[model samples]
Target: MEVDATALAGLQSEVSQLADLFKRRLFEDRSKNALIESVQDQVRAVNDLLRYREFEGLFKEALLAIDRLQSESSTPELVDSVVDELLEVFRRRDLVAVDDSGIFDPRVHEAIGTVPASADLRPNTIAAVHRTGYVLGDRLLRPAQVTVVVSVDD
Candidate 1:
């Protein structure tokens, strides 16, 4: 009994491809796990913030103000708990953006529109955020859509 050389070479090629596929799958799995962990950490932060009683009071009152907001028909207390935590997050200013630079980058700032301001004052600076932003590990959890002011050279 003897093995053919061509058959062995073909077998080796197949094995190599399989090995590469396994490696890629493993890397993807690890990358997805990291993303999941990062998201979980952010969720935990909100949960911790919501645990305060005062925050809960304010959150409930605000929700009650909603005209068409559904107050959770699925879980009895789940909606209340989650809303309190999320509202607490907003109330505490958990979402923030700080830039000493007088210029706004489109990547970091989603400019809804530009405003007119003095060159000595508002040189392309971030005026205000239309919506709040979130941060995670030095990465933007959400980009702040803000209005920036540009100084026109007269």
Candidate 2:
């Protein structure tokens, strides 16, 4: 069968133009997606900063109150009440207390000192926790300040 040369050329031209249009549309879609991702990242960063600031203010207030109570030689019951209130605030914010397991984990615990290992305690284990650590939704807010056990030989 014989086809018209002019008609064939026209069809080819239309196909090429369609291909170019598709390419352009794909590029535009990708560009738009990238821009949206960048904007979302910025918003997430801002939200994190705001959350941190809020937690910082609360912690500062709690610390000041505890300090004042100590200076005033407040009753143990009063101090306990303040501590309970602070813990409640932490719980409400989804800040969980890090467990003080005998195992020492560098990722979640900060060793401030070392103590001689005892028969009851294994070496390299957490001997004491000076300050409690907290985590919020798998994000570590603070590492637990701790003392680790060391061998007497060392």
Candidate 3:
């Protein structure tokens, strides 16, 4: 039996289509997994914030955000909910460290003024954080508005 090239070409086309289908499915699966992992991370971060040891000492910023957004959209935005859920850190001096290091950050901190300090303290060191900052996971929801310090050279 003599096989024609047309039949073989048709078979090759079908195989190519099948391969593409499988490739697309694989890509979709991987993308979906990545999305799920991101959502999980956000959930975990939010959970940690919610169950913080000093829950009452956190702040009223979160609560204020919630109050403003709750009626506007009522969609349960994470930051807004946190605002509502945690509402005690407002009236006192319980500012959470925006950055682990007391480094100066112009982004979150407004350079209202600068001051002189010790030799070890370089300029832009956060001598005082006038305003507390908030974090949403790895993202900085709000930068810590602070006063930077500079070392007075002799």
Candidate 4:
């Protein structure tokens, strides 16, 4: 079977037009996808800023309490009151103080130093705490700075 020259040329032209159409559609789809991704990123950035502003507003009172403690005239009672106020702010923001128990957990504790193990203190246990830590829900905001007890090497 032999295809006519005119018919063959017409088929080739039709195929070329189809190819060009496909290329144009592919480019348009890609452009549309890129624009959509850009919009989504912008929205996510806005949401993050809004969340930061909300947390900042919640800590305003805690900041004021801290400022009061900075004054030289602050007494022990005033210090205690300021501490309580700060804790209240943390609670309002769903933040909790990390528990620094005798047992040291690497997930929430940062070892600052080590002391020799004693009869009362077991190895790898917390001997002292230098700083307190906090957590926001399930996320760790800070690790407790603690001294761990190490076994005495002979």
Scored by lDDT, the top model is 4
lDDT of 2 at 46: 100
Please tell me which model should have the higher TM-score, number 2 or number 4: 4
Model 2, position 4: C-alpha lDDT score: 98
- Quote the lDDT for 48 in model 4: 100
Q: Over 4 Å off in model 4, which ranges?
A: 1-3, 67-72, 119-124, 151-154
The candidate that achieves the highest TM-score relative to the unseen native structure: 4
What overall lDDT goes with each candidate model? 0.70, 0.89, 0.69, 0.91
* Model 4 C-alpha lDDT per residue in residues 1-154, reported as the tens digit of each score: 9989999999999999999999999999999999999999999999999998987877788779878888657788998888898888888888898888878899999999999998998999989999998999899999999999999989
Q: Candidate order by lDDT, highest to lowest?
A: 4, 2, 1, 3
lDDT of 3 at 15: 100
The residue-level lDDT of candidate 3 at 4 comes to: 88
Error of 3 at 63 (Å): 22
Stretches > 4 Å off in candidate 1 = 1-84, 87-103, 119-121
Ordered from best to worst TM-score, the candidate numbers read 4, 2, 1, 3
What is the TM-score of candidate 1? 0.36
State the lDDT at 88 in candidate 1.
Answer: 57
Q: Give one digit per residue, the lDDT tens place, for model 1 in 32-142.
A: 999999999999988887677646765666666442246445464666666565555554544445342447876666788777886445667877668755554467767
Task: Please tell me which model should have the higher TM-score, number 2 or number 3.
Answer: 2
**How well does model 1 score by local distance difference test?**
0.70
